[model samples]
Every structure is written in C-alpha cells, then in structure tokens.
Target: MRCHIFTRDDWGKTLDVQETECGSPEEALQLGSAGVANQPTEVWCGPRRLGRFEPERSHGRPLPRLHALLTLAERRLHEREQHISKQETLINRLKREGRDLALALCVLDTLIETQKTHLHERDLIVAEVAKRFG
Candidate 1:
C-alpha cells in the first residue's frame, strides 16, 4: 500500500492526488517521503472530506517504510505503475519509428502484454513484503 498525497480545489471542488512514479518492482522500489515540518497538517482525500490522517507506522517505532499503501491503494498503484512503464516502452519505440520505418512495429505493443504476465509476480512479492511488515 502506497501512501499518496492529495489536495482539494475549492472552486472546482475536486480532489487532486500526486501519484508515485511507475517503476519496475524489480528496480529500486522507493517509498514516499514522510511528512515534513510546517507543511499542511491536513490532506484532501475527497471533495466531501478534509481531515488529518494518522499514517500507519512500521514496527520499527519512529522509522517507517517509504510508502505505506492501503490494501486497495497497493493494487491500484501497482497497475498504474505497470501501465506507465509499458507506455514508456511504447513511446520509446515510437520515437525510433521514423528511423526504423518497419511494419513489425507492432512488436512494441507486445511489451505491455508481457508486462501483464508479470503482474501476478509483482503481486506475490508485494503481498509477502506487506505481510512481513504489516
């Protein structure tokens, strides 16, 4: 479960959330930074609610893991991250299309399909890690 920072717009009445960057679960899975001093004490989760949230702490007392994701947040975040990664690959391939100019460009589309296969793998790893800490 990754902890996300969200804000609300008064005029539009919309909640804004800063999503984490999508990176490989195999790569360095960095967590979010903890709350800092003098920042807004309250977070906006939705249009109807604005309040302070007690971030769950790790067992290590004062030392918490980077991003503490709620159960649903974890799953959603994972999928979004994977999508971002796949898009990155596709975009990179498209950039080369001008030079390559080949009909087999569809192979680039397969990159995302391969990513779907890895979803369950990442889920297992994340689940195990979460169970260990949570």
Candidate 2:
C-alpha cells in the first residue's frame, strides 16, 4: 500500500503531501518522519491514519489494517476460484454420464424390437402346424 505524508509548509497555512510505498506501516511512518524532520506530520493509507509524528513526541505501531484487509480478500478470492473449478468438473462428468445412459437406452430398444419380431414368427409357425395336424 502507498503511504501519504502530509505536513504544513513555511506559512503554516498551505499543506504539502508526499507519498511513499513501504513494506509495513512502521516503515512508512519511519520514512515519513525522516523525510520531513521537525515538522508536524501525519501518515495515512487511503483514509486510515497510521500514526502521527510531532517534533517532541512520535508514536509508533498503531495497527496493520491494510495488510490484514489485503490478505483476507486474497484468501476469499482463492476459495471462490477453487469452488468454480470443482463445479465445472462435476458438470462435465454429469454430461458424459448422461450421454452414456442415452446410448444404453437405444441398445435396449433395439433388443426389445428383435425379441418381438422373433415371438411373432414363432406364433405364425405354430398356427400353420396346428392347421395341418389338428
């Protein structure tokens, strides 16, 4: 995250802001204070204040808000991506199974038709034999 340092100018009316990208809030605060020594300054990341540095007293180690937020967002996005991938795999498997089932049904239909034809032929032969013998 980028840290913005704001300080007052010579007239104490106009403000000057400088931005720096640092590893941690502590680092940013240290760099901000060192950049503008003996000046009343505040360090910020977006709208959240990391800490304040005064000429007499400087405070350190407030909180690590930006890092925590970024980590959480990244984890959630990874979980969603994994879920989408698993769902796509399941859908493809189901489609393949459905096609196999349709092919089996067509085979069963052909078998049934062949059995009916054989039964009809047997009944005709029986009728002809009974007409000659009885």
Candidate 3:
C-alpha cells in the first residue's frame, strides 16, 4: 500500500509531507499518524465545501385513532341529547307545543337504548340459590 500526505494553510496552499511510502492510502495515514500535533487543523472553505451535518430527531407520541373517534362521537351525542331533552321538557308544560315536544322526545328515545330483560327458569333458580346462600 502507498499513501501520499499533503496539507495546506488557510488558503489551501500545498504543505510539506515529511515521509515517503510505497504503500496504499491506509498505510500512508497510519505512517503519518505519529505523535500528531494537538493543534486544530485549518479548513479550506474557500475552494472545497464541507457538507452540513444533521442530527437525529426525537419522535413524538402517537394517538389511538379508534379511541379518539369514539370519544368524539360520545361527546357529540351527549351534547345533542341534553339540548333535545331541555326543549322537550319546555314543551311538555305547554300543550300548544305538544307536537314539537313529542318530536323531541322521539328523537331522544331513539338515541337512548331501551332496557333488555332476558331470564329463563333455570337461571332464575340459580339466582335464587345464590341469594339464599348469601
């Protein structure tokens, strides 16, 4: 391997290389990398340009889509139901507004689910037994 070392001052003018080697560039770097001076080497920003460095970015937190949508829907429905119920109650006291009140109640009833009752003789017996045991 052979390496040739060349240095320049602020103006990028060619500087002197101490040793000569018949090796590759890697070997040349190793050979010339002796007790190197602790001085900051000057850069030739006039002729050659140095690329800008970019740092790693920190990622932000993610939100759940389904949970967000469900929360939004619940809030909207809750608001709508409150408004309609107020209107229905207002119309209830005044018979002239019965038609509008009924409509509002209908809408509210549709929005609210009815209670479901499902029971069998065997399930009732089991419940009764559990109640007696308690």
Candidate of highest lDDT: 2
**TM-score, per-candidate, Cα-based:** 0.24, 0.36, 0.26
User: For residues 40-123, what per-residue lDDT tens digits would candidate 3 score against the true structure?
Assistant: 122222243222112222331122422343354455556666765775665576556444456666655654532111123224
TM-score: which is higher, 1 or 2?
2
Identify the runs in model 1 with alpha carbons over 4 angstroms from their true place. 1-69, 99-134
Q: Give the RMSD in angstroms, all C-alphas superposed, for model 3.
A: 28.1
After best superposition, candidate 3 residue 129: deviation in angstroms? 39
Query: Which candidate leads the pack in TM-score?
Result: 2
| TM-score of model number 3 | 0.26
Cα lDDT tens digits, model 2, 22-103, are 8898898887778665457878888898876666523421234233433444554455556556655655676777744555
lDDT of 1 by residue, 1-134 (tens): 22344433211232455544334321112222233222222333333223443334434222132233234445655776676676666667767775452433455456556556456545654665667778
lDDT of each: 0.43, 0.60, 0.40
Ranking by TM-score: 2, 3, 1
Clashes of each: 2, 0, 4
Local error of candidate 3 at residue 61 (angstroms): 16
